[model samples]
Target: MLSLFLVALASASLLPGGSEVWLARQWCQEPAPLALWAVATAGNTLGSLINVALGRYARHFQGRRWFPASPQGLARGERWYRRFGEWSLLLAWAPVVGDPLTVLAGVFRLAWWRTTLWLLVAKGGRYALVLWLADAWLAPYC
Candidate 1:
């Protein structure tokens, strides 16, 4: 469980890691799908919270002359946030854009509880889908 949590946390951060492989391997070993899902979701959610804090802190650095600015970039992010609002946290599982999205939520000062809830839904759905696929494709092989 500890290893699973660590893998999920690391994968959710801005790091080159993924818990999916570990999840599949562990499932193969013990077949405790529900437990695996819970651990992964908890770890991923906690890691995402870290990204949110980072984004909140980044607000302090924005608009400094030393930092580059692009109205186009800011505008695009704003448009996205406006369109999705707190629900945008669901996209927090996306590859490249995931971590940044969480940070944007913090920078925009969106409601923390709402953001956390949506993030859990999104991340949990992702883990469930991955586990389902693994069960479908790999179970027979195992």
Candidate 2:
């Protein structure tokens, strides 16, 4: 669980780590699958929420223009949010754009609960898929 939390925290930021690798290892070691999934999901969702909070309070720093607090950027994010709604968070597991997407959701002031819920779904699905694939490809060797 601690490792999963670290992986989630790193992956949620602009870092290059992912909880999927840890998940795959845990699965290969024959740990309790459900417990691993739950912990991974919780950690990932919490990390994403931290990013959302950063976006929510970004306006306080006038010099931090790179934080996506500008009016134009916020407007564009709002348009995208309206068009795609909560499902857009499904892409939150994607690399590069994933972390920023969550931040944008906060900058746009979308419903907090909805954003968090969707983010969890997306991230959880991603971890599950990765675990499944690893098991499928590596089980033959084991």
| CA RMSD per model (angstroms) | 2.4, 2.5
TM-score of each predicted structure versus truth? 0.86, 0.83
Where in model 1 is the C-alpha error above 4 Å? 70-80, 83-85
Task: Report backbone clashes per prediction.
Answer: 0, 0
Q: What is the lDDT of residue 92 in candidate 2?
A: 88
Model 2 misplaced regions, further than 4 Å:
62-73
Task: Tell me model 1's lDDT, rounded to 2 decimals.
Answer: 0.84
Global lDDT scores for all candidate models: 0.84, 0.78
lDDT of 2 by residue, 37-60 (tens): 888888888888888888778746
Pick out the ten consecutive residues of candidate 2 with the lowest summed lDDT. 59-68
What's the TM for model 2?
0.83
